[model samples]
Target: MTLELSEPADVDLEAVRRVARAGEPVRLAPAALAAIGRRRAEFVAFVEAHAGDHLYGITTKHDVAARTVLDDAARAEFGRLLPPTPPSPSTLGPALPERVTRAAVLARLTDILHGTAAIRAETAARLTTLLDGPLPAVPEGGNGDPGDVVALGRLLRPAFQGTLEVGEGMALINGSPMASGVLADAVLSGRDRIARLEQVLALAAVAACLPDMHVDAQLGVLWGDPHQERVLARYRELLAGGTWPRRAYQAPVSFRSAPRVLGGVLRTLAHAQDAATTTLRAASNNPVFVGPDLRPPLGAVLSNGGYHNPLVSPTLGALAHAWADLAQLVTAQLNRLTDPPDGIAAHETEPRTSLFPMTASGWAEQARAAAAPGLVGLGRSGQTDTSTPDVLAWRRATDAGAALDALLGLLAVTATHLVTRRGDTPPPALAGLRDAVLECYPLDTPPLDVAEALDAVLAHLAAR
Candidate 1:
């Protein structure tokens, strides 16, 4: 399917997921393309009319070279030159995954289509053309030097840097689109983890005969948290018509409060999504065109706002911290459910699942350590320092989500293990999930790698 870039503001998490994970093709709408072309022409006319004027990335160089004047030859050379990107000491790792890079590439295309970047239509078209195939490797670490210019350059270098014009080079690399796209992809995947965990809860609840009062919708009104209701609503749907213990003994705190813990995580996830949405639609190019929609169009003006996206940093941190809390909650449930002095795993003995809680405990520790907010720092240029560790923050949150995925999958595996060992019957509604979980058999070490077992279960859980 083709995604048209007409109203760029309409681009959201699902769009990024489709393009990045599903490899959907992108197309700029005719109107947006024409507007981009006209804006590019108008910008050129504006520059020619004001010859000898100093432009941040056009007639003059950037950063420490800000004051350096360039003749026409130097200007042309500067335009095509992919400047050395300062090393990212804070972010150290492999290139961004292809899906994340593809998300960033798709994000950059939206900015060009916004008509504020003043890039030639051909450049934008060329970028979209390349989106049809394999994407270049973008480094995971980068200085927030007016956005991920270093990584953006590597992605664009093969077909892009050779013919860049004045200001066009900056337009290509300038902005927080990389951060935006990373957050978009992270939020999408994080939501999937949340859903999978919910399913795990469904299976566990039925297996334990978790108290109905815990999932009762009225409890949401009593709790006073707006997100609580939606979580309970889903639980109610999944648990409806499920058999419950006739005695109605209260479940342990781990079983009772899981929804509340999840409700709080949902709040934090929404916060990250709000921040991602803002960054995703941002046309945050340096030297951005001032009046592209004007009758004659105003030329570009350089400002520090293009690269100043601190909100993304803390929002990512928040997500990591949230998952850390969830990991702890999952660990508690795992412990109670495993030995089941008497809750979910009542009268159950699954020796193989003994280490599952520890695995989740370890992940919780890792995510907590990585949850520090992005550090804001001054750069070598000493000129601008709106730099936030967005790249690092994005990595932290993405890794946290993965950790949560494993923790929840392990929980699901444990629940299935006990239920099958006891030959229990779950609610009719959970029959399919039971079948899927049953397929994740032989979790013991003879042939199945625990990780592989979890992977099989996770793959099935993800499908639901």
Candidate 2:
């Protein structure tokens, strides 16, 4: 399918996911191309009218030497020279997945289309062609300072040699779109993880046979939050027709508070989504173009810091921390299932032999450690910018991915144990999940790789 990009705000998680994961084609709407052309002309007029004005990184040097002014010839030289200034050597690691690189390229293109970066319409069209064609391999590391710029230059220099104009290369390289794309992918992944988490929580609740009275719809109303209402509604739907008697008046805090806990996660994921959407639509370059939306638009090329994203850093940190909390809750549910209070031991063997619980605990610990905020630093580079939202969002995405894997593993193990204890008759809501679990990890055999199992479960859920 041809994914349309008429406005940056229209590019959401699913849009990025389709291109990044599904290899879908992308196109700029006719209106976007026209607006880009007009904006580029306006920027040129503004530049010619204000030739003596000091513009950071455009008419003048960046960083501490902002006072240095450059003539038109020098400005052109600056564009050519600045991209290679922070030459980054490649390091050893897996290259960024093609989907992510494509998403980043498209995201940068989206920013340029917003007309704030003042890139030429032809440059935007070339970028679209690059996205439509094969992309160069992007190595990991070199993500500090202008590392993204350097990496982008390396990736696109082969294609954009004769096509790009002055200052456009810097505009392409000097923003946080790569990081925005990374966060966009994370948001998509997090949406999947959140859905999976809800499924597992429902499975655990039904497996434990917690009393339906506590999860009543009235309780959701009394809770007085949209998140609680939504979660309670889902729990009620999932736990419907469960015939098993309650294990106790209240099973445990984990079982009782399942809706509330998952609700918090859902809310935080929404916040992350909002932050990512705003960043996706924003002009994250140094000197943004500001003018009225008309021909011969009067505007100024003023220096700004839209690239340093304050919203994404905290949103990512919150998502990581929220997932960690959910991990602990899942771990607690596992404990309850393994060691029920009624003396009916689910696992007759010792805790060491009971690999499921032990594995879940280990995964939970790793998630908690990974949840530490990535924004805690005094900043680096000569600019001394304290927070690196790009790096933080990347790390947070990794952490959230790992946590999702571990959570899926725990859910599979929990579902398997529940089936074993109850003689293969899982509740209707969990019947499909049970089948998936057993297929990935048969009862007679040891569990497979958790990551592999997670991939299967995610695929299963997506297919459903």
What lDDT, from 0 to 1, does candidate 1 have? 0.74
Per-residue lDDT tens digits for candidate 1, residues 1-464, read 98888767857788898888999988888888888888888888776665477777767787768677688788888887655555444346587888888888888876786777888887888888877999876767664654777677778777776687877887887777787877887788778777777878877776566877878888999999988778898888887774445226887787788888889989988888888888888887776766535544455565557766767778888888888777777777777777645443454334454557667778777767767666776665476545667777878887777677777787787776666656666666676777786677443443336667767887887776
TM, every model: 0.91, 0.88
* lDDT for residue 150 in candidate 1, whole number 0-100: 67
User: How do the residues 38-76 of candidate 2 rate in per-residue lDDT, one tens digit apiece?
Assistant: 988888777777768787666776666668788888777
Give the whole-model CA lDDT for all candidates, comma-separated: 0.74, 0.70
Flag clash pairs in model 1.
none
Mark the regions of model 1 whose C-alpha exceeds 4 Å error after superposition.
87-92, 142-146, 244-247, 292-300, 343-351, 384-386, 442-451
Scored against the true structure, residue 355 in model 1 reaches a CA lDDT of: 58
